[model samples]
Target: MFRVLIAVGLLAWTGLSRTATGADATDAQGEVDSARRDALLSQAQDCELRNDYADAERLLRKAAKFPADERVSAEILVRRGDCFMKRGKEHRAYELYKKAIEQYSLYIPFEGVVERLRAVAERFASGEASWFGVKERDMAIEIYELIIAKASSAKQAPADTLRLAQLQTEGDQKLEAVQTYRDLMKRYPKAPEVPEARLDLARLLLDLAKGGDGDGALARQAQHELDLYLQAFPDHSRRAEAETWEAVANERQANALYRLGEFYLRPSHSSVGAARRYLHDVVREYPSAMSADLAKITLARLDQKGIQEPEEAGQPQAAPVAAGVGHAAVVPPPIRPPDKDLTPEKAAPPRPAKTLQAADQVEKWLLPLEDLSEDTGEKAK
Candidate 1:
C-alpha cells in the first residue's frame, strides 16, 4: 500500500510540472509576438514621417500579420490608408479608410478621416503636393469624389463638387466636367460658385462644338448657353470674353452650314440649288463670320457658266495662258531606216568579188602599159 501511494504522488507531480512548462512556453511566445508587433508599428511610423510610403506600407502589412487588439487594428488600418493616400493610391486608400471606419465605428471617432481627406484635397489644390502629372491628378480626383460623395451638408457639397469638376477638366474629362457643372447649377443655383460654374459650362460647350467632328446640335446649345450667360450677367467681369465665345459659336454654326452645303454639292444625286440656298443663307445670316467669306467664294464659283455640277467641273481648269503665247511644240526626231547589213546576223566584210574587182581596177589605172601587156601575153599562152 505504501508503494502504491508513493507511485500515485510521483505521477501527480509529473503532470503538474508538464502543465507549468507548457504555460511558460506559451507566455514567452506571446511576449515575442507583442514585441514584434510593437517594433513593426514603430518602424512604419518612422517611414511615414520620412515620406517613404512604400516601406511604411510594407512594415504596416507585416505588423498586421500579428494578432492585435481592436483599437490597435483600427489604428493600423488608418495609418495604412494614409500611406496609400500619400503614395497616390487613393482608390486603395479609400478601401482602407472604409475598413477602418467599420472597425472603429463602435469605439473610435471618424472625424479624423474626414479631416485627412480634406487636407489631401487642399494640398492638391494649393499645389503643395505636386499633383500635376496624370497619375497624381487622377488619384486626387478619385479622393475628392469619395469626399464629395460623403459631404454632409449643402454648403460642403457645392465646394467639393466644384473642385471635383475643375480637377476633371484639368484631367481631360471634359464631358464629366460639363455634367458636374450642370449638376452644380441645377442643385445649388444660389451657391457662391454658381456663376463660375455657369461660365465654365458655357466654355466647355463651346470647346466641344469647336472639335472637328463635333455635333451641330452641341454648337447650337453652346450658343444658347452663352446667350443666357450674357443676359444673366451683363455686368459680369467676363462678359466680354463670353461675348467673344458667343461669336465663335455663331461662326462655328455658319461654318457647319457651309460644310453641309459643300457636301450636298459633292454628291451626284444632290441638288445644286439646295447647296446654293444653304451657302446664301450663311452669307446673309452671318456676314461677318469667316465661313461667310468662304460661302461667298464658293457661291461665285458655283455661278460660273458650264460648271453647274462637280462632275461637269471635272479636274480643276488650268490657269489661262497669255493671248499670244501657246505651249512650245514637242517635235519628235525623224524616223530612220534599219541597217540590215550592219545587224549581228549579217555582220560580214564587203562582198569579196567587189573587193577584188576594185583592186584590179586600181592596178590597171596605175600600172605601166608594158607590164600589163606582158602579163596578158603570159595569160594567153
Candidate 2:
C-alpha cells in the first residue's frame, strides 16, 4: 500500500510538471517574438550606419509592430531620429529624438538617452542650415545645459560643450565662445578638444587686444593661452602657424606701444622724454624684430628733436642734441673720379728756374743796348 501511494503521488507530480512546462514554452514563444523584434531593431541600426535610410525605415516599421518589446521600440525611435536628421528634417528629427528619449526613460537610464539626444543636437548645429535654424541653436544650448546638469554621470559632456562653443563662435558671439572654451578646459581638463579650445581662445583674445583695449589685458590672456597650446600640442601640424601668430602678436604689441609714444610726442606737446622712453623699451625688448627697427628710427628722430639724457657731470658738455625739426644735414654729392682719358694734359714742365733767370738777364741786357743806340742817334743828329 505504501509503494502504490508513492507511485500515485509521483505520477500526479509529473503531470503537473508537464503542464507548467507547456506554459513556459508558450511564454518563451512570446519572448522569441520579442527577440526577433530586437534583432530587427539592431538591423535598422546597421542600416543607419550604412546610410541606407530606406531599408532602415522598413526594418524599424516592422519592429514597431512588436508592441510588447520596449527596448526594441526605443532603439527604433533613436534610429528613426537619426534618419530624419540625415534627411534634413530638423523639426521631425527633434521630435523623434524627444520621443526616443521619452521611450528610453521607461527602462533605459537617462544618461544613455542624454548622449543620443546631444548627438542629434550636434548634427543640427554642425550643418549649414544652423545659421538660419533658430530651433537648432535653442536645442543645442538646451543640450549643453542638460549635460552640465548631469555632468557627474555624463560621459561625453565635454564634447557637447565644445560643439556648443563652436556654434557660438560661428554665430559671431566671440565673448561667449571664449568663455565657453575656457569653461570646457576647466571642466574637462584632459579632453582632447582642450588644446584646440585654448588655441581658439588665444586667437580671439589677440583680436580683442588689437581692438585697442587698455591694460594689455587681452594680450596677456592670449599669451597665456598660446603658451598652453604650445606646451600641450608641441608637435601639432599647425604648430608653425601658431608660432607665426605668436610672433605677430608680439610685434603688434610693440607697435601699439610705439604708436602710443608717437601720439605723446605729437604737436600737442606731450613729454618727448616719455616718447623716447617708450621707443627705447621697444628697441631693448624686441631687438631682432621689425618693431625694433621702427623703434630705433623713432628714437633717432626724438634725439634730433633736442631730447637729451643726463650725462656725467664732469664730462665736457656733450654737443647739444640736433634740433632736426625738418632739416637733415644735406649729404654732399658723391665725388666723381677723373676720367683717365678726359683728364687735362699734364701741365707743361715748369720752366726751369735757371732758364727763367737767363731770360730775365737777356731782357736787361737788350734794354741797355737800345738806350745806348738812342743816345748815339741823338749825337749823330
Candidate 3:
C-alpha cells in the first residue's frame, strides 16, 4: 500500500511540472513575438516609402499590438512618425519622433542610432534632403548626451563621445564641444582618441579666445591642453598641426595679457607701470609673435609719453622724513663766501661758432666746376 501511494504522488508531481513547463513556453513565445512584429514593421516601412500611407498605418497598428522589444518598438515609433509626417500631420509626427528618440535611447546599440542621426544631419547639411532639419540634428545631440551619460559603463563610449564632440564642433557649438572633449579625456584617458580630442579641445578654446569672449583662465586652459597634446603624442601624424595650434594657444594667452595692459593704459585708470610690465612680458615670452609686435609698439608709445620702462618704473625714490616732536631737526651749515685762491684760474679765448652761411661757402668751395659756377653766381648776388 505504501509503494502504491508513492507512485501515485510521483505521477501527480510529473503532470503538474509538465503543465507548468508548457505555460512557461507559451509565455516565452508570447514575449518573443517581437521578431514577427519587427518583420511586419519593416514591411510597413517599405510600403510607406512607396507612398502607401494607408497600408503602412494598418501594418504599423498591427505591429503595435505585439509585445515588441525596445529596439523594434523604437523603430516602429519612428516609422509611424514618418507615416504621420507623410500624411501632413506634423504635430502628431513630432510627438512620435520624440517618443521614438526616447525609446531608442534605452537600447544597447545606441551608437548605431548615433550613426543614423549623423547621416541624417549630414544629408540635411548637404541639402540632399529637407526631411531632416535642425530639429533632427538637435535630437541627435540629445541622444549623444544620453550616450555620454552612460560612457563609464559602455565599451564604445570613447568613440561615440569623440563623434559627438565632432558633431558639436561642426554645429558651431564650441563650448559644448570643449566640454565633450574634456569628458572624453576624463572617461578614457588611455583611449586612442584622447590625443585628437585634446587637439580639438585646444582648438575650440583658441577659437573662443579669438571670438573676444575669452578670459585669462580660458586661454590658460587652452594652452595647457595644447601643451599636453604635444607632450602626449609627439609622433602623431598631425603633430605639426598640433604644434601650430599650440602656438595659437600661446598667442591667445599673450594677447589676453596684451589687452589687459591696453585697458590699464587708459588715462581714466592709468596704470602705466602695470601696463608696461604686461607688455614687456609679451615681448619677452613671445618675441616674434603678433601680440609681441603690438606690445612693442605700445611700449614705444608709453615711452614717448614719458612712462618709464618696467625696470625703472618699479623703483620708487625714497620719501623724505618729516620733522617730529621727538626728533631733533638738523639744518645744514650756511654757505661761506668763495676764497680768492679757489677762483684764481684764467681761461684762454673761445673759438668762434660756425654759421650756416660759412657752411654753405665751404660746400660751394668743395663742389665741382659746373656746380661752382651756379654757387658763384648766387654768392655774387
- What TM-scores do the predictions have? 0.53, 0.56, 0.55
Compose the digit string of candidate 2's lDDT tens values, residues 1-381: 999999999999999999999999989988998898879878988998899887887788888887665665676676676676677665666676677664466755567667666666675566543656444565666666655665534667777777777777766577888899999998889888787778878887887677785656677678778877888899877788788778876777677667766765665535555566667767876676688898888787766876764343443321322352111122212345876564348545557555445546664456564555665665778
Task: State model 1's lDDT.
Answer: 0.75
Estimate, for each residue in 268-315, the C-alpha lDDT of model 3 and write its tens digit: 545566677678878988786799999999988877888753344435
On lDDT, the candidate that comes out on top is 1
**Candidate 3: regions farther than 4 A off:** 1-57, 66-136, 149-152, 213-215, 262-266, 297-381
Q: State candidate 2's TM-score.
A: 0.56
Report how far residue 108 has shifted in candidate 2, in Å: 3.9
Off by over 4 Å in 2: 1-83, 99-106, 109-119, 126-155, 308-381
> What is residue 108's positional error in candidate 3, in angstroms?
8.7
Model 1 agreement with the true structure over 1-381: per-residue lDDT tens digits: 999999999999999999999999999998999999999999998998899999999999999999888888888888898898888765567678867755575544566776677666655555656646324566667777776665536357788888888888877889999899988888888887776787778778777766653446677767777887888888888888888888888898888778767866764435565577678878988899999999999988877654563343333333333332221111212345876777767688666554445546665467675756665655678
* Positional deviation of residue 370's Cα in model 1 after best superposition, in angstroms: 99
Model 2 per-residue lDDT at 253: 66
